[model samples]
Target: MAGFIEKKALKKFSPGEIICLEGDAGNSMFIIKSGQVEVYNTVDRREIRLAKLGPGEIFGEMSLIDGRPRSATVRAITDVECVEITRAMFDKILAGSPNWLGVFMNVLVERLRIADKKQRVTDSVEIGKKTVYLISLMLEKEEKTTGIIYKQSWKKLVEDISFLLDIPPSQVSGILSKLIFTPLAESEFNYKDGKTFIVKDWERFLKFTRFCKERYLKNITKGIIEEFEVKSEKEVKFLKFINEILKEQARANDIEMEYMNSKCSEILNEDISKYEKVISELVKSGILKKAVRDDGGKYILVDLELFDIKFQKYVDIELFENILKKFEN
Candidate 1:
């Protein structure tokens, strides 16, 4: 303890300089002496701001007290000065402290443990959903009648998915491995060929996977729903009108332009001429498709049911099914 107090040094940082990185080992804590620093975690290449520390505030205390890896990165947000407290000094201080200090440390450790667990659950669900969504789109684009599509090696595919989604490869791989027990089980990996394939029943599997993904990402999708609500104020009326007309046209199974125009004029009390561009825009955007029946005539097909990205089902059948697995031999 002779030189512990005198040996303590002031650390300085420039604005935008990294003070510490997430996941690195750290045994020292910093108490801000001047200016400000930002603490953050990177998930999917996005910096999630955790906290900002200014004069007299603390950073890096969790790892120092808990003997764990750093959970987040810290960067100086402004030119800063801090008093560095190493583990040895920390132990020295604690050794001379009152009984309440031990209680305080225990409380801090418990709170940190709970917070860390919540973050992991949230991130795992998000990464799982995104991985399923990407794979579904890839299989859909292949247009194979039997839902068979070959992709690169399992490891390379995981890396590619991580790169595309900006998520960590470990999180992507871990979440996807759980998909093996679900309907997506038909997807098989061939390490020898350095490739994998989606074999069958993918349409049903994807719908279930997508719904599960949406459920887990309710907070994120809430923003999307809000934006859609704003758009609905402008577009919902026209969309409803068009969808109703398409439903009526199903008997004829033909969505000719002239019929839509006549119906629009009759029911909407407006010229169909103005909405022609909207219809064309819908076709161009793949919300509506032009197709031909056995005869020579062409018609437009629209599936307005799935236009909203939100799920319609109220119950999670998957969860119920899993509970039933308890009776398995």
Candidate 2:
């Protein structure tokens, strides 16, 4: 069946090309002949994958069946070849077919619709990001009337988010309860107004969302088979030296690159010119962020708390998973 269909007007898409965008007007559906594509949608400014389609798979039929805007976006993962069957073309083909064939097609569309609906039941962390975004908007709205540092009542938060995201109030409250476990939340978030939730620094809470999503999406990204759970003895020693440097120095978060160059000589007890490789890897490992000094030299922006956890504790997948697991309503 697929071989016969491939003879139709075929469309070729290269990798990373968008075949269709979510919520766009889509008049046709795609039947994959070869390569791979991913169906995804953006939520909280992040793309959440819905499905992966390979040869002989179909997508975008929902738009044709219901005549609504496309529900999800599709992008080519590899060099892709697909036959785009328009709604009118499909109707014409089905018109010449047996009555049972149209029924079979309808059955396929209904099942796929249900599967896509299930995909939209996003995880709790995604909801947390959405919640933070909503709070930030509310803070801006209420900033003039509030005192220093914006905060919201738990009751208002639950009510608004439940209405905005169309989620139950209980689920929103569950996510908020776990939000306090985050690092920024530990210091800034406090129980007040008779157990009402309050976030002190609006910006810090915003970064918290990105921090969690960065780690969450890291697991979902494909072709990156490496894990930073364990390190070689040499790498561990280097991280220990950096940690000790941070500990001895009172203002250690902004250690200059030139300082690391000096430390390289001291630690190895030889004139090693610079130690750029491991520190660069630390940035990739999410243990450090790069910053710049006034003199135009680079520095490692160390989150002392996260540094201890990921570097000293040698964080494993299960540890971070447990943190996010708490937010799963």
Candidate 3:
């Protein structure tokens, strides 16, 4: 499908050069026509060799569909010769071949289905962003067993959780103290890594998060459905207003007017009219301010929160906390 092969673009891999890193989005699959490569990951402070690929074998195709991050790092074991099949080329080739297309599509679909299932399961888990890793590591260590929330030596708990979250020990201790009042399981266990929280509360927390996600999805669907149902006279006006604002702002900022479409898509979820309506309301309420630049352009800048630079005090901790709690619950 790559009708024009640019030979100049092809390059050779040197020894010890990292072919690909774990968690990198794979844009292409490569066939090792010659030499070798090593795949590995770190677990429990140990480097575990996952696999070694040799000549004539292919790798990294799993990410072609959803462009998922690589599960393991691949390093050149020796000088290697590889031919990369880019995602676009791969798709084109598959599309032209009915038999192969069906096979490839089925494989891609199955892979994505599995990935989605696993992602959904992980998303349903409850714990703070950083702290969740600690809980997961603990659960894994116990051989797929549940957690027991035990109160013990704060010093060791801090050290363990800190390592898990890649934060300082003191910070771990502080976070754990805040969570102590929350529900935890009281399970009996040996002191392998200080005190462990073997709490069954993880399930309840997961259920709550799943419920919130469902409600959020429903609300979004409702909004989209309502939008389609209503007449769009106001929407048309708002879109025109947004286009004008974008042109004015771009000229003021010395940016390309062509970027307006991209910026509108990013900030307004591609709903220029709705974004304009919101901005207009804010301006009418005096919650947002507009400035006219020397280049005959206007820019709107909103002051979201007040801050005291000298004392490092924020004006709305409660508001920020509530927003965070919305995500947490």
Candidate 4:
């Protein structure tokens, strides 16, 4: 069957070209005819190589068989040639051969892969601790600079931590809950305003974070190969968009609230009313100050130092300008 497929015209890939990305719809499998390809999964924004396949190996078959999204990304390691087999061709070939055994084997391999991934995540105690420590540091930075940590800030913090630590946001949330219960830190939850503030015991919390770093540095630093939990890329992009706008306002000292709302709606591709609650929460938490301008227009002011501390790394001047281009009149 492999020889039969290789007899057909093969697709070529340049070194370093992406063949398929994780989470993309997968309808075909590739049978390597020459050169090499690397398979990897992205965790915490870092790529973890799974395997390097040379000629005669297959990739992307699991997704084709299961009718699911690609679980990992594949890229060319060297100039490569592969025979692409679509689902139609796969079915036609299976129908003529004693392929029930092949189907069963593929199913068994996929199930084992999933189970192994689950076991790895369950065993990653040091990774979980390091994630909590990072979140604590972020909270401490926000509190010391802004005097209050808003609900929106917490949402962004969790997302950022998930992206950085390559863990699920739910896992990060569980770690945060445990940290809040610890004696090293105290939190004040404003039910009315939907904000949580780390109002007490800052020094102790910082010390705890330092302790985690010292204790878990070795295990955390050791590179471990594991399947990455996928997250919604759009949500991450949206959070970055919000941070970019806030950073601009922080730098300018003040911005017209109407203009801010319009830009947010444009980026979100939704009505500003959808985010009124979030804006209100920001105001209630003191991250954003709402005031009436002398000319009777409404505006919001941000603390420049606090904003810089929170979003310095997330800002990209080129990306910001390109996003703003769509809103230009």
**TM-score of each model, paired residue for residue:** 0.51, 0.38, 0.34, 0.43
Cα lDDT of candidate 1 equals: 0.66
Q: Which of the predicted structures, 1 or 3, would earn the higher lDDT when compared with the native?
A: 1
lDDT of candidate 4 over 90-166, digit per residue (tens): 77877777868667967886896798577565445566556646766676555254434322245666788888977
lDDT of 1 at 122: 59
Q: Quick one: RMSD of model 1? A: 14.2
Writing each residue's lDDT as its tens digit, candidate 2 over 1-329 gives: 45656676689999999999898997999989899999887765667676899998998887876677998899999999999988888888888989998778777878877875654444555776677667667756765324545556777888898889876787777777776665434223354554455666565555444445555566587322234334555566677777778877974776776677688777776443344576677778777788887888877777777677666343333344555656554
* Predictions: Cα RMSD each: 14.2, 16.2, 18.3, 18.8
Model 3: residues >4 Å from true position, as ranges? 1-11, 22-25, 40-50, 67-72, 99-151, 154-329
Order by TM-score, highest first = 1, 4, 2, 3
Candidate 2: lDDT over CA atoms?
Answer: 0.70
Candidate achieving higher TM-score, 2 or 4: 4
Error of 3 at 161 (Å): 9.5
lDDT of 1 by residue, 1-329 (tens): 53554355578999999998999998899988899999999966878687998998988888888788998999999999988888988887898999889779968887987987777665655566667777666655555644354343456658778889876686666555555555544346454665454536554556556565545556665643231223322244566676577557663334765566677788888886666676676667666777876766656676555433312221234342352232121
Ranked by lDDT from best down, the candidates are: 2, 1, 4, 3
Candidate 1 vs candidate 2, lDDT winner = 2
The per-residue C-alpha lDDT of model 1 at residue 126 equals 58
What are the per-model numbers of colliding residue pairs?
0, 0, 8, 1
Candidate 2 has a TM-score of: 0.38
| Candidate 1 Cα misplacement greater than 4 A, ranges | 1-8, 13-26, 34-57, 68-80, 87-97, 145-160, 187-193, 217-316, 319-329
Among these predicted structures, which one has the highest TM-score?
1
Using lDDT as the yardstick, the better of models 2 and 4 is: 2
List ranges where model 4 is wrong by over 4 Å. Answer: 1-3, 42-51, 99-103, 123-125, 132-178, 181-329
